[model samples]
Structure formats: structure tokens, C-alpha cells
Target: MPRYFTDEHEWIDVEGDTATVGITDYAQGQLGDIVFVELPRVGSEVARGKDAAVVESVKAASDVYAPITGEVTEANGALEDDPALVNSSPEDQGWFFKLTIANKSELDGLMDAAAYKSFCDSL
Candidate 1:
């Protein structure tokens, strides 16, 4: 799978035409302890750069954006009860949702791991 990062701090791991979405480790670290998550419903169409979910932490609530336009295929139900998984494992079990990619071309606009690391380092 190939992973990409968005400027809004979201990550997408592409596998075939579906992509798994989540907040970056950096984002989780900045959010402190996560307490709640509001997920988008399956079958909902999300536009690139639009708000798709909400993650609330002890510090503040943050919007999770769609890295690319697509239909939400599934959401991580585990997050509803254990939002702290985002802090402990943002890239794996903490993934927010999966989407069937609408346009593969949109991915070219996102950053690869190297570029994303540089972008994060600059901040």
C-alpha cells in the first residue's frame, strides 16, 4: 500500500481503489488525549478537502478532512468506545474510515512520506 499525507494532517493509505484514512501521529500528539470521535456514515460521499469526521481531545476538537473525494465504505466502530486508540496507534487501529477513491489523480496533489515529513519538520 502507498500512503499519502495532506496539509490538514490527514493520512491515506491506498490499496487498489480504496483508501484507509486517519490522522497523522503528529496530529494525535498535538491533540493530546482523544476522548471522542464522530465518524461519517458509510455510503456518504465526501469531497476532497471537506470535513468528513470529528475528533475531540482533552485539548480541543479537530475536524478530520477528506484527503480525496470518494464514498465512505466503512468507519472504524472501535473508535466510538475507545477514542484513545488514536493516541496510541493513529496509523493502524485508529484509522477513521475507508473510502472508495473517486479520482486517483487527486492523490498527486498530496505529499509522500518524505515530503510530508519535511512539511511537518518545517512546522
Candidate 2:
């Protein structure tokens, strides 16, 4: 019911057995200007806590990891043409993918909003 975020600054919204995943606003801010995004193919299998994609920004390149084991069901192809959306809306329209969650138990290892906020502050 609540959003979760990783120490690396990726965020996820889990609903039922599915999850919507993306980089956080802070991540985009740290990355500066996003220029390119390399996303996983739909249907690709992703392991829990593994790198599943890469976002290349003007400042640097960062990998996006799977919040939990899952299959990529959808990718935001819109980023191909307009990566700036990530800078403007990291939590909304900039979402990178929709995953068909495969290892729900892995969610337990993820940080809830409050924890994530503290984690963000630590960075």
C-alpha cells in the first residue's frame, strides 16, 4: 500500500503482485540531466535486487535494479524521445517500467517510505 525506495534511489509502488518501478526524484536530481535510458525488454525476467536497466544522464550513468524478482511487462518507451520527463516527474509520468512481480517475499527487504526518507538523508 505504501511506496518503497532503495538506497540507490529507485522507487516502487507495489499493488497486489505487481509493481511499478522507477528512479526517484532525488536520483534524477543527482544525475543532473537525463539523456538516455536503457530499459529491459517486455517479458524479460529480472532477478530480485539485480540491475535490470541503466539510465544515462549528463552527469553519469546509473543502473536501475529490480525491487524484487519479476518479469518486465511494460517499459516507458516515451523516454526514448524525451528523457527530461525523468527530471520533471520522477514519481509520476517518468516511471520507467511496470513489472509482474515474481518474488513478493523480496518486498520485505525493501525500505518503506519513512525508512527510505532516512536513507535518502544519509546520502
Candidate 3:
């Protein structure tokens, strides 16, 4: 899997034409304790840079943007029961959704792990 990051702090792990999406660990850390997540409905169309989900934490509610345009295939059901997973395992089990990518070219504009780290460092 090739992982990419958005300036907005979202991460996507691409595998074939399907990709899994989530907020970066840095995002979870900044949000404090997560309380709820409003995931995009499966089969819904998502546009790159558009809001795909919402995460609510003790500090505030934040939109989770789509890193690439696609049709959502799955949304993490675990978040409904344990939103804190976004805090505990943000890069792994805390994943938000999976989608069938609509445009692979959009990935070229995203940052790789090292670049993302540098971007976060500069912030």
C-alpha cells in the first residue's frame, strides 16, 4: 500500500483502485478526545477536497475531507461505538472509510510520508 497525506491532515492508503481514508495521528492529537464520527454513507460520491465526514471531539467538531474523489465503499462501523479509536490508533484501526478511487492522478498532488512530516513540522 502507498500512503499519501493532505495538507488538511488526512491520510489515504491506496491499494489498487480502492483506498482507505483516515485522519492523521497529528489530527487526532490536535482534536483531543474524540466523541463521535459522522461517516459518509456507503456508495455516496465524494469529491477531492470536499468534506466527506465529521469528527467530534471534546475540543470541537472538524470536517474530514476526502483526499481523492471516489465512491465510498465502506465506513468504519467501529467508530460509531468507539470514536476514541481515532485517538488511540489513528493510522490503523481508526480508519474512517474505503472508496473506489475515481481519479488516480489526484494522488500525485498529495504528499508522501516524509513530505507530510515536513509539512507538519512547519505548522
Reference-based lDDT, each prediction:
0.94, 0.86, 0.95
Write one digit per residue (lDDT tens) for candidate 1, span 5-79: 999999999999999999999999998999999999999999998899998888788888898999999999999
Off by over 4 Å in 2: none
When sorted by lDDT, best at the front, the candidate numbers are 3, 1, 2
Scored against the true structure, residue 109 in model 3 reaches a CA lDDT of: 82
Clashing residue pairs, backbone N/CA/C < 3 A, model 2: none
Could you estimate the TM-score for every candidate? 0.97, 0.92, 0.98
Candidate 2 per-residue C-alpha lDDT over 37-118 given as tens digits, one digit per residue, 9 for 90 to 100 = 9989999998866889898988788888776788899999888889889999999999998898876777777788888888
Steric clashes per prediction: 0, 0, 0
TM-score of 3: 0.98
Q: After superposition, how far is residue 121 of candidate 2 from its true place, in Å?
A: 1.4
Q: Residue-wise lDDT of candidate 3 within 33-94, one digit each (tens)?
A: 99999999999999998999999998788888898999999999999999999999999999
Against the true structure, candidate 1 reaches a TM-score of: 0.97
lDDT of 2 at 23: 87
